[model samples]
Target: MGFGFVATQILAVSLPILLGWALNKLGIIGGDLDNRLSTLVLNVALPCSILASIDGAEALPDAGTLVLLMLATGVTYVIAIAVALVMAFLLRDTEDARVSYRFAIAFGNCGFIGLPVVGAILGAEAVLYAAIALIPANVILFAVGPLFFIDATADAGRPADRLRGVLASLKTPTLAASVAVLVLALAGVNRLGVAGQALGIVGQMATPLALLITGSSMAHYRPLEMLGNPRAYVAAAGRLLIVPLASLIAVNLFPLSPFLRAVIVLDGAMPVATLGALYCLKSGRDTKPMMQVTFLSVVFSVVTIPLVSLVL
Candidate 1:
């Protein structure tokens, strides 16, 4: 059953990529569709799925295991980032490569990839736990992830200007929406039936749209350059395999609930967030490598995610 669930998510994620590629190849979808799909994903689908899965979830798991799992994740991410640093330095990679590698390890595709994978592996309730995990993940992304990229390039403006950029990043609509959904779920209000139903419909769209957008973005890549980048492969391996394997070992020994354990294990197994490309763009780094990392990470997760799921 668990393996089947993992397969469900793997298919859900992969279908859009394959479909988008096909549609583009057939001239049925254009570049503009990618932008629209991205907006639908971030603005509507993601929040709805979260709300639908978590709303009225009164049987929240014991904090002991969840807390331990969260801590384990944080520790694993820190370790992965350290490994990425060593890899970047050993290869004599550029500042952008270092930043991209670190960011890839630091940020996992929690919502875009994590929610559906958790849902399939452990049912909707696991996704509820995934929502809980997202709080800390957001903290790391909006606060810590930015710091790594910020220093990669020089600041041309005053200190105040730099501070403002950090502040602006904090106000991201996606983060704000995730927070809103979490707060409402905790309150147990459900926001009435129509609102919840509407949210669910939107949530269902997120995975497909995200896959499509990622696929479209991937259409811009150079295959030889992508294949030649060793950092991208290592980064994918660290994010999809090493971190999750370490988490699975810790989780098995930690006295955690099965559900929390599942969430933690899946969270660690997530692919690299495609948004890393945007971060690299903002930080004045070359985006081609980051895109390569994202594309490859998603591809490998087809095998890695199911392996992680079966272990959980």
Candidate 2:
């Protein structure tokens, strides 16, 4: 069953690459399709997806699930940070490389890849649990993640700047959607109603659009280059293997629901976040190692994710 689930996800992720390659070959790659698709996913589809998952629920998850989720999320981050520190210590040659390695290991592609895969395997309710898990992860990613890039020699900015960054990060559409859906669920909204049905119809597009964008972007890179980087290989091992194993242990200790446990483990097992390399680029840092790690981790997840599913 695990292998079957992994196979389905791999096929979903790969078909778009072929489509992207065909688009490139036919000179149809010059349009703003990437941006358009991205906007649709982030703004329209993802929010609807979240809402559709929760809008019909009689109530939010029990307090126990919420508490366990918070604890498990914290443990996941701690494990990620610990693994990253170990990697940095072992591979310490340059500050930039250290930062990139740590960042890549600490953040996985939970939103783009994890959501669809978990939704397919564990069902839509599992996806909702994953979204709840994402709140803290995103907070750490956008808030504390930038601090990793700041050099000790650089002047730390004012408190206002840090507060602003944190606030800005929390303003993401998906997060807003999560909050809204939870609110509606608590308020007992009927998801089978006209509004709910409309959202569900639009929400169905999120998974495909996300996978297609990932596949299309991947087509432009050379697999050989990604595979050859030693640092990237190290990061990939940590991201795909060590972190997931640790997350599995941590989640198991908490007595979460079976679906929640599966969601946490699978999300933890995912490849490097697609945006990690982009963040590196925007920060004027060396993006090669980050890109290599991202590509290699993703390439290898087809195997690792399935293995993780078996454990769950």
Candidate 3:
């Protein structure tokens, strides 16, 4: 995409985020509505968006290319986890601090920020690649995600629980939708006719809805407090800067198309997943560390994501 196209796409995506923040601040939408809308976007709009992208695509990658994309994505995550482990040692103040660093750096806001931004800036075709990338990310997140925030020694975390999480991760709505769409596309079912039209209409909602939820979620966190954490700044640097740079080097080893290459770079460039904060809250862990990184990485990303686009 041209710089002009990227700029237009960023502005279009950024507007909903601003509006969502304003709406939450004014109490027009928050609490239950925000939660429900998040569910709607993740389960409905985002999946439909994935399907519609493939349905409308003029071309489809062969099964081998898709497998290669999955492996490339898996390698990216492995590199990220290794980076997180190394950084955790450098930041070893407390176990909690190490946990925060590892979690924040290793995973990204791929679904909420990466998906929409890629779709908007790179077109729907890129979103298909983004969807493919999500498979390995989610699998790793499930298999070992909680260990980042949950102490291995904690009594509350059982082996069975971890195994269940891994199994359940296999069934996430987004993953399910993505796999289903890929099968259909492979079977020459690209055009769903009227169903395709309906899906496209619903799919259009994913970007705006995901960003709105992101903005509204940000409203609940204290920006000044989030900004003041120097430790969080360290984590943000690893996430927003270090990880993307490392991902670029790692992805280059593969013979990927420029489109797949851009997807990996943009994926690495995204901010912390807002889901991480929610996970901390539900687990009764201190959410402050990740919330800070999430807030700062997000506020900084409007600039950084565009910068990463230049590399594409």
Candidate 4:
């Protein structure tokens, strides 16, 4: 069953990626089409999914599940940050590399990859669990990840400007969606049946659109750029393997719900997020490493994620 679930997830994700590649190669989808698809996924599809998931799962969560999630996530993040800091300090000697290291360590493509994969393995219930996991992950990605990059680049420019950059990023649809979901969830509005149903319909679009954007973007993937980069290899190991592996080992000592344990490990195993580039672009850091990290991490996650799932 685990193998079958993993196979389904790989197919679901890979199909859209192939479609995106085909579309882009055919010139039927390029330029503004990519941007529009991204906007649709980031702004509309994602927020709707969050609201819908919360609405669907709104009964006060099971105590065991909630505790399991908190422990798994908390342990994973703590270990990831520690390992990332050590890795960054080791790999980084230059200003740009240091900042890029921070982004590589902290951000994982949880939404675009994690949710769908988890949903495939564990079902929509697991997606809801994954969504809860993303709450903190996205916050760190948007709020903290860029700040590290900006600060790293501070020697080249004034440090204070990074504040404005962070503020500006607050307007992005993904961050805005995070806020919206949290607001609606806390207010108990998503629990209302009519509102919940509407949210579900919109939310359903997130996974498919996200996969398509991934596929399209990946269609243009540059293997030469990523294949031999030592930094890229390190980042991939950190995000797709080491960080998750460390978390899994720690999780073994705890008495958490099996589902939540599985979800957390799965989330940790996701590839480096594409948003790392957005952070680099916005913060005046080098984007090359971020791209490398993202590409390699995604490339290898096909093997890494299933391995994590199996052990869990």
Candidate with top TM-score is 3
> Of models 3 and 4, which has the larger TM-score?
3
TM-score of each: 0.85, 0.91, 0.95, 0.84
User: Would you list the rank order by TM-score, best first?
Assistant: 3, 2, 1, 4
Q: Rate the local accuracy (lDDT) of all candidates.
A: 0.70, 0.77, 0.81, 0.72
RMSD of each: 3.0, 2.2, 1.6, 3.3
Give the least accurate 10-residue stretch of model 1, judged by summed lDDT.
Answer: 183-192
lDDT of 3 at 124: 76
Clashing pairs for model 4 are 17-215, 48-203, 49-203
Best by lDDT: 3
Candidate 1 residue lDDT tens string, 263-308: 7778768888766887788777787767777778877888888887
Q: Give the lDDT of residue 216 in candidate 3.
A: 88
TM-score of 1: 0.85
Model 4, runs deviating above 4 Å:
55-68, 92-94, 151-191, 252-255
Clashing pairs for model 3 are none
Clashing pairs in 1: 45-202, 49-203
> Against the true structure, candidate 2 has what lDDT?
0.77
Error of 4 at 35 (Å): 1.7
